[model samples]
Target: MTDHEDDLGPRVASFRELRGMSLRALAAAAGVSTSFLSQLENGRTNASVASLRKIAGALGVSPAELLDERAAHTRGVLRADRRPRLEGALGVEKFVLSLPPLRNLEVYAGEFAPGASTGANPYTHGNAQEMFVVIEGTVVFELGGERFEMSRDDSIEFLSSVPHRIVNESEAEARVIWINSPPTPDEAHGA
Candidate 1:
C-alpha cells in the first residue's frame, strides 16, 4: 500500500472518534463487518474503493476527506508540497487549497491528465453553489445531461446538487479550480 493508504486507518479512527461513533455503530451504518472496520482502523487491512465509499458516506464525508491529511507547518497557508490531496478517479489529482479552519468555503486545485475524469458517472453533493474554472488546456463539464466544453480561463457555475463531472479529453493536461460555497459534506454535515 502507498503512504496515503497507510494513513487512511488513522484518519478513519480520528473522524469516527470525533463523530462519537463506535466501531460497531460505524460498521453497521456502513454495512461492513466490525472485524473489517477494526482491522482497517488498526492498519491490519486495506479498504477497497467500494468499502471506502460506504464508510465515507456513513460518516457524511467524501472518500477524499478520509484519505487526506493536513501536512502544512504554517497556519492559514498550505505549502505546495504539504497540501492535502486526493488521488481522484482516472488520473485526476485534486489538491485542497483551503487550509484548516475551513469555514463555509472550499477550494480545490486539480490537474487532470489526458483522458482523466472525475469519474465514470456524474455525482451530486452539498446544497451550496459550485463553480468550475479551467486554468489551462481543455475540459468538458457535464452538468445534468448537458456537456459544456471549456478552455483556458473559461468557467461555469451551478448548484452543488446538480449531477456533474469534469473530463479532460485533450491530449495535454488540464489545470482547473473548483470552488464550493458553504463547503460540502464537511461543514455542510456539521463536521
Candidate 2:
C-alpha cells in the first residue's frame, strides 16, 4: 500500500469516532458491510472512490477532507466564520474550536439561548478529562447527583464520563466553552 493508503484507515476511524458513529451505523449509512468498514478502518483494506464518497457524505464532510492528511496536521488559523458548528439539542449552538486530527485536546465554544439546555436528561461520554467555563451569563450544570449554578468566568473540571447537562435558565443568552484532554470520541460531534 502507498503512504496515503496506510494513513487512510486510521483517518477513517478518527472521523467515524469524531462523528460519534458506530461501525455498523456508518456502514449502514454508506451502504457498505460492517466487516468491510472494519477492514477499511483497520488498514486491512482500501476503499473505492464511490465508497469513499459515500462515507464522506455520511460524515457531512467532503472527500478531500478525508483524503488530505495535512488538513489535520497543519498549523493554521481557523477563522471564526469557518468554525464547524455541531448539531445538538435545540437553542444551543456549539462550535468546534480545535482543528482536525484532534490529538491530546479539543475545545468548543457554545452559545445557549434563553431557557436553552443540552437536554432534559443528563448524558456522559468517554473517560477524558473535561473542563467547562462560563464566558457570559449564568448556567445551571448538573453533574452526577449535584447541581451547580455558574456565571461568567466560572469553570468546572470533571471526567467526561460523568453524567452532566447545562441549562441556561436566565432570560438572556449564555455563552460557554468546553475543553477536553485526550479528546472524547463518544458524543464528539454533538453535545
TM-score of each: 0.58, 0.61
- Which lDDT tens digits does candidate 1 get at residues 1-191? 99988989888887776555689988998999999999999999999999999998887677888877762112234588988886578688889886534445778899999998988888888878988899999999999999999999999989988888888999999999988886788533210
Best by lDDT: 2
In terms of TM-score, how similar is model 2 to the real structure?
Answer: 0.61
Q: 5-106 in candidate 2: lDDT tens per residue?
A: 888888878787775568998899889999999999999999999999998777667788778786533334789899999887899999999765445688
**Model 2 lDDT vs. the true structure?**
0.85
Cα-based lDDT for every prediction: 0.82, 0.85
Lowest summed lDDT across 10 adjacent residues in model 2 is found at 68-77
Which stretches of model 1 miss by more than 4 angstroms?
1-77, 187-191
Worst 10 residues of 1 by lDDT: 69-78
